[model samples]
Target chain A: MNEIKIFSPATVANVSCGFDVMGFCLDTVGDEMVIRKVDKKGIVITKVEGFDLPLETELNVAGVSAIAMYNAIEVDFGFEIEIYKNIKPGSGIGSSAASAVGSVFGMNELLGRPFNKTQLTEFAIKGEALASKCEHADNLAPALFGGFTLVKSVSPLQVLEIPTPEDLYATIIHPQIEIKTSESRAVLPKEVKLSNAIEQWANLGSLVHALHTSDYDLIKSALKDVIIEPHRSKLIPLFNEAKSSAIDAGALGCGISGSGPSIFSLSKGLDVANNVKANFENVYADLVIDYDIHISKINTKGVKIIG
Target chain B: MNEIKIFSPATVANVSCGFDVMGFCLDTVGDEMVIRKVDKKGIVITKVEGFDLPLETELNVAGVSAIAMYNAIEVDFGFEIEIYKNIKPGSGIGSSAASAVGSVFGMNELLGRPFNKTQLTEFAIKGEALASKCEHADNLAPALFGGFTLVKSVSPLQVLEIPTPEDLYATIIHPQIEIKTSESRAVLPKEVKLSNAIEQWANLGSLVHALHTSDYDLIKSALKDVIIEPHRSKLIPLFNEAKSSAIDAGALGCGISGSGPSIFSLSKGLDVANNVKANFENVYADLVIDYDIHISKINTKGVKIIG
Candidate 1:
């Protein structure tokens, strides 16, 4: 396949109890990309649509990630890329990750799958680092491997694909406010109470077990964040109200997705997910802030060919 | 079933990355107890053997736990308990937990099993608090529910029983040194680095996932302690050497079992577990320190009726 068209899904990172390590893919929201092998010797971004992101190879996440992948292998011909962005940058829904994963996924497909998903993740994070300002695999892993992912360690780049329950769905509400990743990280304390840390890890452990067993009640109980959310949620408008509304509308759990301005609620079924979305919409409707809301099933396929 | 004699299993809590939350039962190392109903008004420790322990109801963990259970229930009669101790106190194994669990379990059995294991754990922790100076279900949950357990929460207590892989075994080496629970706890920092906390939770989440899927390699990778072990291991003699020897002998992972002095290693099979035990024996043999070592399969049944 000399030319490839692929849909790269968006992702939710720092999933409540699983801060800095866990994430899940969203099926309905993503970025579409088209790539073609050319006789050129270097990576190039031919076009970017729907968002005025940087087109320069060094500045754009997609270009940077593709360059990382390209430099690692001996490819005589280079690739030209076109990105159709749907996920807003800094929406707290892994916008950069979608772009980063899209380019490498397409390249790997064109190269007859030379690299594995883990290697693709490694390449993708190089681009992701430009956005997050550090190497983190929580978003990149899910965007590549799909479903739920737990980044066991960043240094070793170990990512474990946790099972996604069939009925699980996510409702996301993105309030039109920019919370820069660096700024969001700044609000967090360098140290956390050891007791709270223990509670957080216990919740994380149980949440992982709940996912494997498909135990909704356990999931409800386990999806708590005692560390990062308290500090970061202050930056988001009506964060508590949105979370409460979603939970009251039958979401299993609700929390600030990634660094915020976006809040995510997980529910067991599509109907509940829709209910959560409606509640989120209601939460933002009275406010002057512009917002976007979506309901999505768990995406089992990360980045896949569309044409 | 008015009177019963039972064997209560020992447990290794704080399993590597799972400090303050996780534990598993041991098959061969435990304590024995006999509990019988009487028309008396309150819990009574009728006899004590195999070790010098408090026979007073309030001072004895079994009696304290039995009283807790007794106070919660509408029992017409009190209970008599006789102890035959096997697990050594302050060995970093669940010695107090066995006694605490034994009384409540026997009472529940004699009463036609009115309280569930979770409720029994609630009563058991009342006694465990006497030993550890806090209510922790890590050891009690495993000693009651058997196999592996994660105490997700201490307040409004929630315990999750994790599946034990059929081939899994534990090798425990107890060095004859005293590390009081309070002293061990005092060694831990009140706060930890947020980065380290994230790493710990990630390992714990992955460890729980590994247990559910029976992934040995994942377990091996996930069984890491980055938070509490650094401070607590200093209290244990030859902690680093013992861990290295265990890993060198094919153990999946090794760390301070509960607090200090005792170290536990997990392996995939009986042969490797035995090898780990032998290596542990070798580590302490050349030194002047006396040590005890035992290898046992994962105990799926916790406290059980013996006669």
Candidate 2:
């Protein structure tokens, strides 16, 4: 009998000012992937729950990841992968990333962990590229390094593991609305105003410094996006109102989760996190509020195997 | 007899990615202000030099800075300020910043150093506000800090002083051409595509990481600007050739200096700096090369009193 393995962890991509260059793993609300060696020289995937995901080699997130990893290393191993999808897809919770990352991570362990974190991240990106049609490291960094990670550079893939502050709490509210990555991406303009770009860089620079020095106030002030958020927010109904409520309820910063419909907030304490979660609930009363409020700390461990 | 007083070093506003929010002071270039107390309770301008400068309060950089400072702080003391400008006006080398910063520094000393670096920087920003008609901190931070400084936040005006690596050499080539800040500002688009913004953020994040770790290769890779440099490059004659020459001569990175007309290159050693300078000289033989080929070290000391 083949053994069953599982790897799961939540992830936040496009972290506040970092946009595509930063992300982090959370202790809860992630996807689990189980892989077992098969006799045949081909890959197979089973999507178990939460997301109505596809099972085809190219369409399935886990299958794509497994195939990319195997092909990149020229491995002829056949494997059957199962994605126990916990995080809702299109919820800005890195749902797809969890599957992709989990598959790569589990397979890497099954294959004796031949690749490093970067190599794993690259494999994860290949999966993401198939889904999003663009290679981005935002989700991959956190899924690999764990905790609060900065994808400092994508090509040659540099990941910096930022020290997560002790008082930090994340309050994630999923509004159960679908905002496809492609559609969310379409609303944004092809060119950004120089003024907006300057502000973005300024905020991003401050955000990096804040993360490095653990300056909470700087983080609060720098959690602004004049570039992508404004247009992307328009796609999500009551997005601005939800964000405003979170801020008023004592969030250090709040923005659309991943790409939208799901919103996340960083706060100083559990009380603030609760307040922020309640605020989001209050604002979007009509929507299905799946409150995954976590006073939980950053996940220093990303994807890991469970037997 | 008139009292001799020295002023703050003029700064290069917007150190590439840190536009409007980041700046650094240069030791070699600045403006000098000599202030002697007079019987009248109003600022009296004695002389202004270094390019055809305007002495009128609204039009003059130093005059506007002095006016803003006096108005804000309600200083009743009158003094004669003679400006000995080393940084040429409209040279994209923060010539106007030097004047404004010089005025603030000179006045602060004349007022018995009543303000700290932060306070002086705020006062200097009055100068920047007057010159650019926009409140920006990039030039002021460098003028006040005197090194590769990062403006972490502009509103509460937080600045982080980054240590410049010892092995770094800066080769600045002033082509003697003029590109007005207004024109440069106008040429850039108001809206950038989401993809381009992502790339910009990626590069910017990498650059910050590079700066922190002193990773020269990462810095070289991260110095790319897909947003402003390309559009602004058109205005600067032989910009492409100069950049190529500088890079071929062993510079780590090359880009437009501040706005344009002046281009700078980051190199590893004195040999590289000399080689870069020689290359620039060879390429643009007719244009008088103002090669500021100096060892690139972080300016630890910002503005100081010199008698």
Candidate 3:
């Protein structure tokens, strides 16, 4: 049997208004998975590097992803799977999503690429659900398609590719913190004031418009979050100072990436991007700032197999 | 003293999730305001046409718009303002907004067009506030700038022009019923479930993404309103049928235009637009369905003299 290896980029889920439905792949961060077909009747898993990840078929991130695909499609072929964990677990940078999506993408290749992008996304989402208990596609879509992507609907797992301006730059700062997705989900209120909801929608609408037109000023103004950010910011250390420093350093906007701990800043120019990184590093002294900024154009190309 | 003829396009406020902060102008339906400066120091009443409009300044749509503009800029110049209303009042096609925006546009022209589009939008919003008691820019921004415009912020009135797809088409239907904006606003819940709010934001976020990329399918899926439309639909007669017919007739999606009584359908081609218009006309027997099938194009010259 031919050996297949595929690498899936780590993704940023939630993405403000998108919550469980929207996400994008990061070029500089993600995970790698290798799959090889064998005569064994059951799936076997191995984890390499970073964190003591679960290896159980029912409990592990990669194992769940592979099992979901096998059950859904009734694929009886057994395989050995290896996950190269690069994205830090629980950093809120879609660490689990990288593993889940990478499993499906690698498995698909090993199985001769039977499923399309949308189909792969569905299988990956099942893996995500097992890990997060929420049917979210934000991370999976971007992982599969690359760049800045939007998930229109979750039930059918509809994804849309939005145009990202060439001048756009992203600076991500992963503060070393352990905040589980389940914990963050619990902190959110079950009911929200109608006024706050309206403001969130308005800002979200404007953000989309700004992105489409490549209007920096509108993007800057619309990057505000009146609902989730206010509540989640309290969990992150020096969240306000970090956001303020990023904005003051000339970022168009700054916000908590995914759930918490990690933060991303969007800038219009390289100079501003560097400045934002510097400010973020200065504000959070203990923060392990990833100076290797994901400064490429919006990753339009999602997950692809490497020979 | 100068004679000026100005036309302001009818606007669709809210534009789905934007509520008070977003709007766009319709090329086919609008109000025309002809203003002539008079020697008097105070504003004077003039002629009003299209729809049985009231004559009193307080009750008059055009009068309130003029007053809002005058109050904002402290203009003492008196003028005879004739509102040649084309878009019907209380049709949810921005009838009042057309008058309000028209008045500001006309007055600016009568005063040698001093204020810019943003300034005119501010004045129009003030006029809108008088009628709705809430400062919303959705109608004003579109009326003042035309095309798919976004209100990034309300307090400082930040606005941006979103890219309009070349093949974009809009088919609007006026159901001839009176669904007042006040009543529509009254029906909406004071609070929303947190789950619903997140879904709304997710859909809204995707809608913006779809608009930017001209993703027709995504737009169709994202046009849903789980919060406002369900409640407001009960008020408008044949709301569900009109939408169903419109979608069946090849519309990408259909929703209440602004508040209600009018339904707007989006499509990708002219043939679909015509079909959608016919569908609405067939279902609503008692209504005057004006099929304003417009190509999605930005109106750069907003509220100006037609020389």
Candidate 4:
């Protein structure tokens, strides 16, 4: 297969109590990419559509990630990538991760599946760093491995693929307000109270167990952020209102999606997810900011061949 | 049942990454007690054996826990408890928890199980506070719920009973050197770095997932303590040597059982657990301090009736 067209899914990072460690893939929102091997020496970003992004090989996430994977393999020819972006950057729904994971996934498929998911995730992290300004795998791992992923250790890059409940769905709302990655990170405290940290880990542990057992009630109880959200939520407009509305609408839990300007909520079924989406719309309609809402089932398959 | 004899197992709290939140019950190391319904209006400790402990209802853990459960119910008759203790206090093996849980468990059984495991744990925590000086349930939850337990929250009192693998075993070593609970508490930092907390929670989340999936390799990788172990290990003599020896002897993971002086290692099977026990023996043999070691399977029944 010299050419492959694939769909790379969006992801939600900093999942409530699992800040900087846990994330899950989304089924509905994503980016479409086409990659084809050519006789050229290096990677080339031939085209980009739907959103204004750098087409240069070094500037674009797809190009950078593709190059990372490309340099590690023994290949005589280079690859060309074309990305049709649907997820907006800085939307806090892993727009960069979709582009990052897409290039490596498509190239791996065309290269006869030369690398495993972890290796692909490693390559994707380089691309993700281009947008997020850090090499974090919470989003990249889920985007590569699908389902819920836990970045257990970053130095060793060990990620655990947690089971997603059958009825689990995600409702995401991206407010059209930009929050810079630097500012988003700057809002975080360097030190946290030991008691709060313990509570956060306890909630995270319970959340992982709830996912394995498919206990929706436990998920609701475990979906709390006592450390990161209190400070970062201040950066997002109407974050409190959005979260409260989502919870009232029967979302199992709701919190800031990534950094800010976007929020994600988990529900047990498609009906409740749609309800959460509607409530998000109701809450955001009163504001002047333009917001987009998407309801998606937990993506069991991360990047898939489309053509 | 007018009178009943029971076996109440010891437990290991703060299991590696799950500090103050996770614990598991032990099958071999435990205490025995006899509880009976009496015509008296309050709890009575008629006889105490094997260890010197206060017989007063307010001072003794068993009497205190029994009173907590007894006060909540409208029983026309009181109860009599006889303690036959085997576990040593301050061993970091939940000796206090055994007595605390044993009393509530036996009282509940005699009272036709008026309380659930969570209610029993709440009562047990009251007794555990007499020794630990804190209201925590990591030990009490497992002693009552059996298997593994995660104390998600202390305020509303939530505990999650996690599944134990079929082949899982524990090796515990008590160095006999006393590490005061106050000194242990003083060693912990009030605040921790955000990065370390993230790593700690990540490991904890993975550990829970590993337990659910029964993946020994994942458990080995996930059973790490990045936040609490470093400071607390200093309180225990030869902690590093014992942990290294246990790991070298095929233990999956090892850490301070609760605060200090006692260390617990988890292995996949009985043979590996015994090997870990022998290694612990070798490590502590050079020290002048007297030490004791016990090997136990993961106890599925927390407190059981023997007569």
Candidate 5:
């Protein structure tokens, strides 16, 4: 049977230092899609569930990505996909990337694996562009390939797989609110001081080195986000306080995940991650808004065949 | 018999993509210093040669760095240093850094190796501050540690050693012209577009990853310097044609070495480096000004105790 189900993990873009170039996957949250072959020559969206996203093939990422893949392959085959998105859109944790990646990942398998992971990512980017105006691969690269990924350049479509330390844990807090990606991006300064930019580049270089070497102290020193965070942190309530609390609770570094309404803290171990989660809970204790806290290791596998 | 001689190699800072954050040593040109213990508690510069640099202990980097190291030790001991400078001053190949690194490296040896390399780098930065207002280590760190070096952070003084591939070679062209570092810096824009800054950061992060993984193609793609070169290249004569010639001649990437007057090209093999050197020579052949060409492997051993 030419049918398969693909599960695409939720991804975190920006990753603190790299604004539009860095991303990583999380195993705890994801989206699933079931794809099957048809006798026709176009993509068909059978169902869209878990959110009020569009069902039209041109509007939805799942259908749009499948169509993009079909266009690239130019084959006389059709695909029908059922989308089951779990990550909420506008949560700043790469919600659309899951749907976009799942579609092409499932379709590629249904077509006898016609495209590589990188090629699938390109089609997924087309889907992401259909939904979002920006043509970024930070989320798409991680969602398609799993683990940590660096989209060094998008034109030639170069994606690098970064090594993740086994003991490193990620703790995320998603507040029940919405901060549109466009609005979050619009608030950033059009011009940045060259001195600050130099510092940022230095930190990004250091962070990459730390990730490869598994140096905990270097990670802490290099986790700072001076440019984007200073402007975007205004969108989230108690972002600085929560970050401070997480650091006080033994977290290595903490910052806003993606744009806002969701914050993440990276810790050295399970005990520290759990303690940092408790600290986050303390910061939002009296708040009336609902929130959820999830703790897990960095996902090493991106999209996988489930059934 | 507490006497030592240290050879500190010339270094290329900025490395095209990482302005003020990256640097590497050259195997061909360098500075040598001779240091010996004295009976008193004050450092002295017994000899200064090669260039018109100051011989006064507080005026020259060799003497200033030696005094800085002596003060840090706070021991009832003194040292006398003799400088045999080979790297031309203001040539953009870390002329001052070679002197500064050599002084502390030699003093540490005479003091029975009191400080580690990192501690020695701190004293060397103080030496650099004596000549230049900015306490930069882009050149000094690599001069002391050898190989490719990253000045991760200057506040607490963190320098990281980046891995180098075996086949990597460097080609340098030092046109006999003077472009002061301050004037080169002054020509740059005080603020850069956020988009350009993001691109620069992405490139820097990619360059570090490429160096670690030895991905030569990625290095070539990420070696674009959009911020400083566009402004500073105007000061250098025949900059673009030489760069184009080197690239066409098989150099992986080429750019201004530090501030100006000296330019470097990185190539995959020794043959390519030599050919790129010839290409640069051809570009400058029509010019009436005197120029020098140097082709060498990356100096992985930074500074060494020569005698």
Candidate 6:
């Protein structure tokens, strides 16, 4: 009861039609953190594993997020935390969110679960902001609450965990390359056409409807991102070919995950998810590229205690 | 079996956050049409009622829509159509949609239902174009599909009929004023801030979730219209007061119905709907204005054969 080891799942943000408002949690790849209450007055990083992330307590995403949660509570205590990073930073899948959510979730449990999910998410975003440089919760929400989450409004810190069909699956391909979130975001248009905006909202509506109704064909039709993907795809190598190949292999649709260097596709069955992976492997082979592919069902349980 | 009378309900498009992608049909207010098969090879309007709409076949929205359906069937037959108007044009409701949908629905019945709801909607838009001068299906889709409808893609003609909660009710107030659709549309900004667009999309995503889950509080939060309501409220009389009063009276939310001149509010119960209606009357009384109000649940049956 004095210490705990917790896990936070990886996440995919801006899921095609969702743009800045949507994201989903993944089941396989994530981050692990061990937190124990200390006698000192502030957080400290005892150890870090798997990647060369910052060792300073305030500098790391997990440490920063833990600090936010520590400051929110009235406990005159500190924590020494150990992190095992699995989701690589700049993977465009939620590397930072996994770390941030993992730390906050673990710290909350160590403090006897003082805060609810929404309150914990607020603290988590502070840690995410350290890396993202903006207080956006789209990535952290699903990592915190699990499944498909919508950041309805950041000002009010409103979020909703939407339902997904049991048979749905996700196929993600993360290329062994770095693309800064800043660089990826800089390519998007400042102003979208009104007609295009209408089309985008309609697709978003359909995507949400498809999720509620469990309609696969409707989901396929709803996954085309007309605005951001068209502009940002150029930043990611072989983006078009990978997307087209995935669709050709029966992916519902494909697009850049979060920002760039990684792409994802949705499928209704294991066969389609595997087919999408094979298609991605072929594209990488054709271009002499290196990539890591993960086939996972949508994660229902978010950050949880492992030990 | 040769003659039939069909009624198409009026619709409210752009339900707050949806803009041009969503609409819902009404139960009490609509338009009626009578169609008969004659020994001819084309469609014709033998009689007209109410306002002085164009009598020429191609000029009338109803006539124009009927022609689109008649041409598609290749039945080597014609229709003699009679229009009886009830829904008032320029009410900021889908009056034109009623005419267009009523005619196509009646003629399809005369043609022995050759076209389904989707096909009938396609022909109906051709008639709607004669009125709006643009082939937008936001209004007609609901008139055909009934209940809540989403025009997911205008290009591929993707439309969906969204489910509504059994207890959800709508309160609409039509002020005795005229605001042309052109004039209403002219007020919108050509480009919206990306921040606002993000906020808008989040509201839309929440709205869809609310509809699916039947969460009243979620529906209230999701019903807020930031982009269009602010711009279009200027065209309507006492819009802010009416909206505030409706919300104060326990209505979920209120905003301009389609563009302006007419306003609609959503409530969870009949008592609140009536309370909203009384509040709107108070607003009109304070402004020395005249308005007509209708209170009803979400219409489940759309265009129907009457006689």
Evaluate every candidate with DockQ and list the scores.
0.93, 0.52, 0.60, 0.93, 0.88, 0.76
Worst lDDT run of 10 residues, candidate 4 chain B, spans B125-134
lDDT of 4: 0.91
Off by over 4 Å in 6: A38-42, A74-78, A286-289, B286-289
Highest lDDT against the true fold, candidate? 1
User: Candidate 6 residues A161-221, lDDT tens each?
Assistant: 8888787889999988877777877888888776677677888888899888889999999
Candidate 6 lDDT over B144-238, as tens digits, reads 88888989877779899788878888999999888877888799988776666767778888888888888889999999777888999998878
Writing each residue's lDDT as its tens digit, candidate 3 over B1-307 gives 3877877777666665545555666776667778877777555558887767777876776677777677666555577788788776677777777778777777787677788888887777766777667887777777778777767667887787765666767777766666666788789898889878877877877766766677778778777778888898898778799889988887777777788767777788888888877777678766554333333323444566753
* Tens-place lDDT digits, model 1, residues B50-159: 77889999999999999999998886778899999999888888999999999999999999988999999999999998877888888999999999999988889999
Per-residue CA lDDT of model 5 for B1-307, tens digit only, reads: 5888888899999998899989999998998889888888798898888998887889998788777777777777788888998899888899888988898888777767879999998988988887677898999988888889999888889999999888899999999998876788789999999989998999999999999999999889989999999999899999999999989998889999988689999999999999998899999999988887888899999899888
Give the worst 10-residue stretch by lDDT in candidate 6 chain B. B191-200
Lowest lDDT 10-residue stretch of candidate 4 chain A: A152-161
Model 1 lDDT, residue B237, Cα: 82
- Considering only N, C-alpha and C atoms within 3 Å, which residue pairs clash in candidate 5? A146-A302, B146-B302
* CA lDDT of every candidate: 0.92, 0.74, 0.74, 0.91, 0.88, 0.87
Better of 1 and 5 by DockQ: 1
Q: Candidate 1, clashing residue pairs?
A: none
lDDT of 4 at B99: 96
List iRMS (one decimal) for every candidate: 0.6, 2.3, 2.0, 0.6, 0.7, 1.2
Compared with the true structure, model 6 gives a TM-score of 0.95
Q: What is candidate 5's lDDT per residue for A1-307, written digit by digit as tens? A: 6888878888888878878888888888888889888888788888888888887899888787778788777767788888888888888788888888898888777667878888998889988887678677899998888887889889989899878878888999998887876788789999999989999899899888888888999988888888899999999988999999999999989888877688988999999999999999999999898898889798888889989
Candidate 2 residue B269 C-alpha distance from true site, Å: 3.5
lDDT of 2 by residue, B1-307 (tens): 3365875675655555555565656665567777676777777677887667766666777777777677766555676778888776666767777777777777766677677777776766777777677776777778777777777656777777765666776777777776777898888777777667777776776666666667788778777778778888899878899899988998887887688667777777779888988988878876554444333334557766788
Query: Clash totals for all models, in order?
Result: 0, 11, 8, 0, 2, 0
**Residue A243 miss distance in model 4 (angstroms):** 0.8
